[model samples]
Target: MLIAHRKKRNLWPSEVYRVKFIDEAIITVQSGDGGRGCVSFRREKFIPRGGPDGGDGGKGGDVILEASSQKRTLYFFRYRKDFKAKNGAGGQGKRKAGKHGDDLVLEIPPGTVIGDADTGQVIKDLTKPGEKYIIAKGGRGGRGNARFKTSTNRAPRFAQPGESGEILKLKLELKLLADVGIIGLPNAGKSTLISAISSAHPKTGSYPFTTLVPNLGVVKTDWGEPFVVADIPGLIEGAHKGAGLGIRFLRHIERTRILIHLIDSSSIDPADPLMSYKTINKELEMYNKELAKKSQIVVLNKIDMPDAKKAVDIFQAFAKGIKIILISALTGEGIDNLKSKIVQSLDKLDKLDE
Candidate 1:
């Protein structure tokens, strides 16, 4: 029950090859072929009786996938859809065995899920860094002609051919790992708020959807441990149904323990103060119930605006019992208080889990 992203190129007609590839990459991995066996005869001047002196072929290389913390997205695999390992060397004469091929290690971001492209089967889930999984095993080497030398048949002339390598079509999906996820409609100042609270320096513009990719930042508090936060792409009405950025990037926040529901006070409707808030929650529920169930810190942003006070008052009047924080990301108002609240909420969740 997975949906493809709205924005994608028609790389392949099959669903296995359909990925916008920003967060997902569909590619092929090929292992090396085994080397051919060698055939030779030992003719020593000093020794009269010299038997066959052939050697066995080398084994092919394997295709390995490694999890790394350095990569944040699947961007590197956009143009590169195919990966290949080294081929083993051929066997040498005088009973010398051939050299083995090197393994190909592809590094992917942590929390990446590997799946088979053709069957859509789960291969492995790499959650921690430095994890590795070998998908394709190398072919076995062929035996030399010396092995055929027996009492009845002596000095065999032929050798075995190399075995072919394996080829597989695989798909990769990256899910961001963060303590908190910032969710709201477009132009709700999510990027700005994250920048103000954390070390992340994302581009801030007045236009909507300016922040295309998700931004991760680490918030260090004086009293508690540092927590990671992500500024997800904006969500509008019908987002779950592929409207706007849609559910394409929503999967990135699946691991987040809490959500920061931000809203722009100036954009609040006087007739319906909770329209935007309700819309975002509805989209979350439609996309995933767990997302809606996550604890949220409702924040009203852009309080420095002239009409923000009246709009905030209207929203608070309608939203009874819901504690809301007011902040102006541009002026850095109530940002510290908001950060403190986030730490407190995270600590409470940890205690409950324990």
Candidate 2:
């Protein structure tokens, strides 16, 4: 029920992809095969009949996934679906052991969760910057015939063969890792607010679906404390049911600690401001009840309009008990006040977590 971003790639302001949460991806990984054992018999002039001498086989390679903070998308995995590792070498005579195989390393963005595609069980969650997880283990090497030679059997003939490596079909899904998520309907000034507060430049217009993907920014308050903010694409009615561009982006909001719901004050349906507010909340509840319960701040944007008072009155009457702030992203009016409230809210949330 999800819709892929249909906007032409060139139409996007930045060619750099801003994919935040990837719902599904399939990966086929193959470990290297174990090497074969050698077979030989010692025949010397001094010793009439010497014992058998067979070398052991080497182990197969492993496949690994490392969590990296540099990567932000799973798009790289889309093209290369197959992953393979090297095989170990066989052992030689004189009880020499075989060489072990090399391991293959894959780097993924932080907050990525790995799951088995077939079984649907959660394998690992990559939350830290440099966390490492082994997706598939390598095969064990075979024992040499010399190891089998004992007091009872001085001339062992056969050596054990190496075990085969593991093969897995895995799926990688990404969850948005930001501290805060900005949500609102199209043209509600979500992008403008982010641009005003941080350095992220998302395409802005009066049209809907201007943003097809999530955008991230680092906002530093006057106190010099920095917090990560994500601008998720707009959500419309029935977004939880996969009605608009919002359904594809709703998952990204799951990782955020707070939600800032923005509303356009200049909207014609003076009551449209509050309607937009309730519709987003309904969609959130439909998709995830816990997401709807998260801490939220209702923001009435573009307050520089002449009819701003009407929007504020309607929102205040309908959405009571919810903290609401009025601001103009263009003129930067009341931006500092908004920042203060956000900082205070974050401080409280952090303390509660502690």
Candidate 3:
């Protein structure tokens, strides 16, 4: 006896990747078509003649996008390029209207922005959960012959045709939302600091780009109020011009309430640290000046190194009035002080709202 073999499909990776913001994805959305109207006459043995009894047709389904806080990435729709809704049912005789088509609901990550492929103008920015936006409206149903029956025209020969469904080429972009964003070059100890403060475990390595996807950590201050922090991927030179992974993840920092720029003090050339800082700032200004205007904090990492001791002093002298801190993520040096300062800043912002 011959046995049929069952094939196993590779499951999608649950492991998150540190994705840059500049990638482009195309999605084709089609609304359901309206059902056709039915033309039928009602006749009974008792009643010889009955007025026009054709029922009206049902409306087509619509395409809707809903924001979900639980979803952190748009990877769900990455493979599925096509999205469609169900069509409405047709009408029947004796003034019975057909059922309307079911609406298609798409759950997307918070901070998702929808835009038209042609114009590139943003349609909706989904900032809050449960927020919904209609990208494509369903077509209207056609009227039946019964609707056309009037005093002047008693008998209508034909019924109106259904309207055409809407078709749109759409694009969705996701930007992470957090109270604070940590940015720096790869291996700058961003992952270490986040791991020290929160439960999020971002991949850490001696090599570059160990943390592929943005990592969110919940930092609870002394008062026990928790705030969110996001670690953006490493950005290299020419990131504003789409060089490397720089362009892909810059937008993720756009919605941050505050920016914490981490710098590595232990480097081959001491001046290279400051230069990297300036390069990242320049790239931020080039991409969006408003990003440069957001609140900023400068941190010098790997201060436990003997060579980094004097470098921190020199860096502080050049930092001028900007708030700067020396921290050793591996040793947990100055981690509490940094957390306190972050809480102070967040507290001030909250008080302002009150």
Candidate 4:
């Protein structure tokens, strides 16, 4: 069963207002109504019997949703619950057509999934930058009296009314789009590793639960290509069942192509070095089997610590067939090699897709 963990809060003062990341939002959207058609007759000094000369009404505006890389969250939608497009202009006399209503283009973060609020059906999954989807379609323009003029009725006086626009109640869910996802237990150096590889500055502390939200960073390699990485909050044994902060952040890493499973080398037990490793994987499997099936790279972090060598050796012995990387995020050791490996894995995945 799914549960909502977010809470509503009032907007703080400018000085104290931090950039709060929101992943979900419920909103109402309405397209503009079509303008009414005109009914008029041509009247001139020389003309004896004037004919119908009314023009057609303009079309209503559509409500469009566009994906953007600049936005990271759905924070803007917290206060703004409704969105409306402009109404079209009415037709004028002398066979003149009315102007079309302007379209409303709302920019949202990439990897946002728009769904119908009532039916819970997914409307669109916007994962690419600059991708656009029309959530609400505008009404069609009305016909003028000139179109009704026929042989029997030479000068028609009536005009067709414009159609009504579409209205929709939508649910926007944002899943962070990252090439790599860093997952591990609490205080396992996930935040430290992201800070070392990319420009993101996630808060790090000695205690657990330091990271409340997922942090994204863009890692630029020497090969000139940059890939995005996300540092997800730690998971516990019963994380799939809403234990700890796991459920709140697990969805953020769903879009990642690769997973970097980081382990604390210093805290690993020699008797059961793979205990934490197995527990984390079990949680992933319980939450989503596909998430557990994704390609993963096991990494032992905090190798700079004095007693880490013994634990690392024990873990290596148990994980004999699995490939592992040893790194010290605080000392910046093995980060370059880690970046190279990530790039190579990404390249292989891209080739397979092609």
Per-model TM-score on C-alpha atoms: 0.53, 0.54, 0.52, 0.55
Error of 3 at 194 (Å): 0.9
TM-score of 2: 0.54
Please provide, for model 2 over 247-344, each residue's C-alpha lDDT reduced to its tens digit, 9 standing for 90 to 100: 78778779788999888878736535467777889989989999999989888899898878876887787777877899999999989998888878
Ten-residue stretch with the least lDDT total in model 4: 1-10
lDDT tens digits by residue: candidate 4, 1-354: 112323311233423312223257999999987877889999999997799989988998999999976565665787899999987777778988878889999988888999998999999999887999988988877888988999999989898787788989999987536789999999999999999998688889897877767787767788545677889888988999888886677877887889999999998988888999999999999999999999999999999999888888999999889999999999999999999999899888877866
Q: Residue 57 in candidate 2 has what lDDT? A: 76
lDDT, model 4, position 181: 93
* Residue range 192-308, candidate 3, lDDT tens digits: 989988756777888776665677766656654556788867877888887645456677778877888888888625565368788878888888999988888888899998889
Worst lDDT 10-window in candidate 3: 1-10
lDDT agreement of model 3 with the native = 0.76
On lDDT, the candidate that comes out on top is 4
Note the Cα lDDT for every prediction shown. Answer: 0.83, 0.79, 0.76, 0.85
Flag regions of model 1 displaced more than 4 Å.
1-176
lDDT of 1 by residue, 34-119 (tens): 88888978879997768887887888899999887555556578779999888777777898878888989998887889999889
